[model samples]
Target: MLTRTAIYEGTIRDGREEEFFRRVREELEPLWRRFPGVTAVRVQRMQARDEDARPIAMILEMDFPDQATIDACLASPIRPESHAATVEVMKLFDGRFYHLVGAATVLAPAA
Candidate 1:
């Protein structure tokens, strides 16, 4: 499987934290779910990290069967639509967003 993860490192605009998450759940999540070949969408909320670490408010993980699926989704017509939604959602944050794409590994216990 392939997993594309986005670690959103930023701060919610003052008085916007509640609204920010609302849009993320209501607006942005659906876009990620509808992406072609996306098998699953997982959203993680972070509480706290090290004292001197970048504050990552949230993490998004979208899983696909393979890289081909991800590439197809990226090239699909919905790309522009998703981009627009991303732009709107990002307006709630104070810093930049980042992403990484890689193969997912699931380790099983040895018998």
Candidate 2:
């Protein structure tokens, strides 16, 4: 399995925390679930972090069967639509987002 993760590095604009998350759940998540060939979608909101660590407001993980599916999803018409939606959602945030793609490794627990 391949997982693509988006790291949202920054803070939500002051006084907009509640509204920010509300918009994510109400707006962005629906569009994310529509990505072609996506097997799963996971969203995480940061609660606490080490003092020295960079501020990460949230993390988004999308699972795909393989690179080809990822490519197709990225090339799909949803890309532009999602991008525009994301830009609207990001207006409440004061940071940047970056993505990482990696092969998933799951280890079995010892019996």
Candidate 3:
């Protein structure tokens, strides 16, 4: 499996945190779920982080069967739609976002 993770690094505007998250769920999530070949979509809202670490308000993970599927999804028409929606959602945010694609490896628990 391959995962494309979007890291939203920065602070959410004061008093707009709830609205920011709400818009992400209501507006962006639907478009994300529609991406072709997407196996899973996960959104993480930061609750706490190391005091010295850079602030991260959210993280978005989209899983696909492989790199090819991820490429196709990114090349699809839905990509633009999602980008537009993301711009709207970012109005309440105060930082930048970027993506990292990597292979996923799941390990069984040690017995």
Best by TM-score: 3
TM-score of each: 0.90, 0.95, 0.96
lDDT of 3 by residue, 1-85 (tens): 8889999999999999889988998999999999999999999998889979999999999999988899899899999999998
lDDT of 2 by residue, 1-111 (tens): 999999999999999999999999998899999999999999999999999999999999999999999999999999898889889989999999999999967989999
Q: Model 1 — TM-score against the truth?
A: 0.90
| Full-model lDDT, candidate 3 | 0.94
Q: Which one is best on lDDT?
A: 2
Displacement of the residue 6 alpha carbon in candidate 3, Å: 0.1
Error of 3 at 64 (Å): 0.5
Worst 10 residues of 3 by lDDT: 98-107
Over 4 Å off, model 1: 108-111
Q: Which model, 1 or 2, shows the larger TM-score?
A: 2
> How far does residue 91 in candidate 2 sit from its true spot (Å)?
0.9
In candidate 1, clashing pairs total: 0
Residue pairs clashing in model 2 are none
lDDT of 1 by residue, 1-111 (tens): 888999899888899988989999988888888999998999998877999998898999999998889889999988798889888988989987888998856889998
Task: Provide the global lDDT of candidate 2 against the true structure.
Answer: 0.95
